[model samples]
Target: MSVAPVLEKCRAEGRAALIGYLPVGFPTVEGSIAAMRVLVDSGVDIIEIGVPYSDPVMDGPVIQDAAVRALAVGVRLSDIFTAAEAVAGAGAGALVMTYWNPVLRYGVERFATDLAAAGGAGLITPDLIPDEAGDWIAAADRHDLDKVFLVAPSSTPERLEAVTAQCRGFVYATAVMGVTGARASVGEAAGALVSRTREHTDLPVCVGLGVSDGDQAAEVGRFADGVIVGSALVRCLTEAATPAEGLTALGVLARDLAAGVGRGRS
Candidate 1:
């Protein structure tokens, strides 16, 4: 019921939980749902569903394309909740990630209410600044939803303290300076970033952005609480000729990444 319990279970098992990201309505609502089911079945610990918006400043080319396709199909906040509900009904936990504009457009209280009813464990508004998050943060708290925030290598001690204080669910530590995608290596900067965040908060720190393979996931798991993979998995789905093929590819990647993180923790 709570993300804390799921995270704790993974920690107790000595396994680094896999958090997979996908933009809602990439191929279509149906295709996204199918992919989500496959990821859950393949042992993903948590799902980060991207709510498509017109302007996605932080997203890279891969996620941006998916969001644009989703919007072209008329994907809205309501549709995102519907998809999340389906995944939750299938016994999977999820976190909805979106920019703040969509949340404001939907009305904070109403959006939070829908998300909670849909069985979402948390919300991640990457563009939500800590100083300006009171309204939605209050709404999320009222609905008992975890409000997750991001911290970067550039965050100062003052900024880290502020983010840590306002953050719940888990802290997302960006592994690179740019948008999301896979890279050849996790890099020393990411390791240093996680270490700095650890000094500011005891909460779980999940490293994301540019993590493409099990080896990278394993490497990140060595320093962070969890590992997040996005573009590589999305690319796999995008290349699939059919939904079934896409699901198959996603499942294989999830399994391999899970196994990689498991080995690292062991």
Candidate 2:
């Protein structure tokens, strides 16, 4: 399904949807694909496939470790698109999240085209500011790819307005001041951040960062249209000895989180 329609469905249900992230080639290309399939089968609404970069500034230790392992296995931008294609071919909606440096290295227009051809629905570059998004946004728009933007608690009202305007698929509402990981509670700060973003745009808001476990997922789900679990999921994959074992663990966790969101809505 298209990004907008999928988000619309989630909103109509009053339950936040699950968006899972896993660094490509974490275990291996094959392992990543298997994990994605399991996630989809476990009822993930959307999948964010991370493109491994040498320097991932926004990622925490878990994701950083995953990226290091992926890079060691020679996972490049091209390999990420290949894995995305495999996921898309399986009838899953996939989004490619990467650093701008890799896209520039691969050529922005070429990367967008390749991503679209691989059935990617959108692109997310956390470090790409709106002021400098002209070329990348234009390229993504040329290929009908949704350009997802991030809004942190640190953003000013004006900056939030600008980000909301540029965002297409959905706005990723970062719940904490630091990198991605699990937290005990989302707290009032996160709720206020979500409320502030809602004042600017009607786009579906998906809360990420510091969300781990079913309870936190449910908490964010109570206030946002979607909940993104990254570091926690990555931790599961990294701890598993085999890809199959990782997939099983992730699928069970996903289902539990999904159940939490469902219960929250009810």
Candidate 3:
């Protein structure tokens, strides 16, 4: 994935990449795929196809509710490959954000191979820190897959160095300490965290969690390489009464956030 080439493109164009997150099989596997196409067409720089996990510890209530609905329908691992293929075709790099246990159960080597064949850019293991990710690291490398690791604001300088050193695409910087959700305003600590993380590596660091609107995207985009929005987009689909409405809302949010990425601090 060349360290997430889509992100590099956005940087060349003079903007922070806009990364959108949607859990696969949300409304339905097909419905989620359709919504993703809308997001890609509307200028989403990257797509995070969330693999629905029973115990999504890092997710907030909105995402947890959506995942529960998907799981109820028996949405399996294969469904994610299908979603990834479709989303990748829409011109946005598709990466799976999943918990460690599911990938472990599916077999790391097999999972990485299948994901590469499905045109996936990589994996984002939210619960699996780099220090304990030896097997995943090897598997991803063998398959030429990008492995994105998360770095929290609380991480020490040494911890940040270790995490960034292992990260392939971009470092997922969790803006807040808690689980993911929309917030009114981004905190000052987020910028400081980005600053602290930059001291460790030159790789792109993307800020996620608690970002909901364009203004907040612009705020984070000013200092980070990318802005990741998840709960807000999921809420859009969850609130929609029909697929048409959902897709429409998704496009609207995508465009708004895309615009925000280019409007970062002067």
Tens-digit lDDT track of model 1 for 14-127: 877788898888788888988988888888888888898888899888888878888998776788897888778877678898899988988999998889988988788789
Residue 16 error for model 1, in Å?
1.4
Candidate 1: stretches off by over 4 Å: none
Worst 10 residues of 2 by lDDT: 1-10
Compose the digit string of candidate 2's lDDT tens values, residues 1-266: 24777778878887888888988887888788788888778878888999988899999989999999988988767887787887777666788888889999889999888888888887888999878999988987889998998999998999999999999899988988998777777777788999999999998888899888888888888988888989888888999987778888998898888887877767
Screening candidate 3 with a backbone cut-off below 3 angstroms (N, C-alpha, C), the clashing residue pairs are none
Candidate 2 residue pairs in backbone clash: none
* Worst ten in a row by lDDT for model 1: 1-10
Better of 2 and 3 by TM-score: 3
- Measured with C-alpha atoms, the lDDT of residue 3 in candidate 2 is 73
lDDT tens digits, residues 171-202, model 3?
A: 99999889999998779878888999999988
Off by over 4 Å in 3: none
Q: Which candidate is the best by lDDT?
A: 3
On the 0 to 100 scale, the lDDT of residue 130 in model 3 is: 88
